[model samples]
Target: MTNPVKGPTGRVPGWVKVVGSVVLLLAVLFAGLRLSVLPGLKDLFGTETRDRSGPALLESIQDISRYEAASGNFQVVVDLEKDAKFLPDAVRGSRTLYVGAGTVDAYVDLGALDGDDVRVDDDRTSATLRLPHARLGTPALDPERSYAVSKQRGLLDRLGDLFSDNPHSEQAVQKLAVRHIGDAAKESGLTGRAESNTTEMLENLLRSLGFKEVRVTYGD
Candidate 1:
């Protein structure tokens, strides 16, 4: 039998060359498919999101008898940090910086007025009224205006977040912000301004009602 032709030393066999060429062609085709078609497939299969929420229900209606006389806007920066007892920050601690914005309203309750609260002169030219002092309402935080500035978490904290439903909750910081805003409103003379505004409003209304002199007073 004749011997098969042999290539030079270190040279690859003809069948090996054929197999390599086929592999190269297949690799090029696969790369082209990845560049052109894979993205569309991904979008069609696993990339879309759907909202599955239920419709909102109207709970209750309330009648507001308080007149808003003043509003104060406030902003606060909250820096909160938590660390483990014996571990370093890099291993078990978290720090968050947040900006909170809210508003506090001061008002006078008109529904609390009784018949004895108002007295008119015999000639109907003068009036006297006694009302309760203005009070501050609950602070309302503006979600659109509030945001987290920065967050740093240790390895353990990050790993814990993967299993938690609310990975990064702002409830604590939000409560702190509300407290600060409420305190600031108390120090801002908002209630005093509300009282003054209510007095002015009542005086104007009484004068328009034919009373020449109006005396408005606030009690505890």
Candidate 2:
């Protein structure tokens, strides 16, 4: 006869066998659930699948039309210190000083190119492309780089700040920063550089497509 299984108390281990079986069953269930949900887990994690290559794979020319050629970045700093007096000659006033930094992007817009704007030689050896003027996009204020340096309020002005929910002085400073940065970008010749860069880009692209010569020009 086979020897009987002896537990710690010298009897058959009925409870231990049941606990082991339960643990094994739970593990198998967990593995099965994991395998079933594996496919959709990527979506839950915000991972996307797509083709990032150029639009040359499109079937027709209409699908691959507009291109934004960003060519220049302008960095600007603006400083302002102003005192606003409520009364004509009163000494009480609010004084604020702020410094802001931002970047402006210059790019060439090519969305309106028509057949008349592009001409390719019959032999595909040369091409001419007329593009629109280079324009400055909106200035982006870098919040992390911009701040109010100092703020001073007179006796009367300090009382107003205690109950005011809006930060009027800070807002004014930000507006001034944007206006000055825009003006600086225009005076810096960044737009001209953008135009040159965009021309060079198109020339290189055309050359890749077997073009021996490429002429790019800007139109009003």
The 10-residue segment of model 2 with minimum total lDDT is 63-72
Tens digits of lDDT, candidate 1, 28-127? 8897677666666645445567999999999999999998999999999989899899999999999989999999999999888888998998999999
Models 1 onward score TM values of 0.77, 0.63
User: Candidate 1, residue 161: CA error in Å?
Assistant: 0.4
RMSD of 2: 20.0
Give the clash count for each candidate: 0, 0
Q: How many angstroms is residue 56 displaced in model 1 relative to the true structure, after the best TM-score fit?
A: 2.4
Candidate 1 global CA lDDT score: 0.91
Prediction 2 global C-alpha lDDT:
0.74
lDDT digits (tens) for residues 1-220 of candidate 2: 4446665567768886898899999999997678667997645655578988876675655542334455334444444444554562134665566777888778776768889999998999989988888888788778887877677666666677778887454777788888888888888887788888888888888889899999998878
Candidate with the greatest TM-score versus the true structure: 1
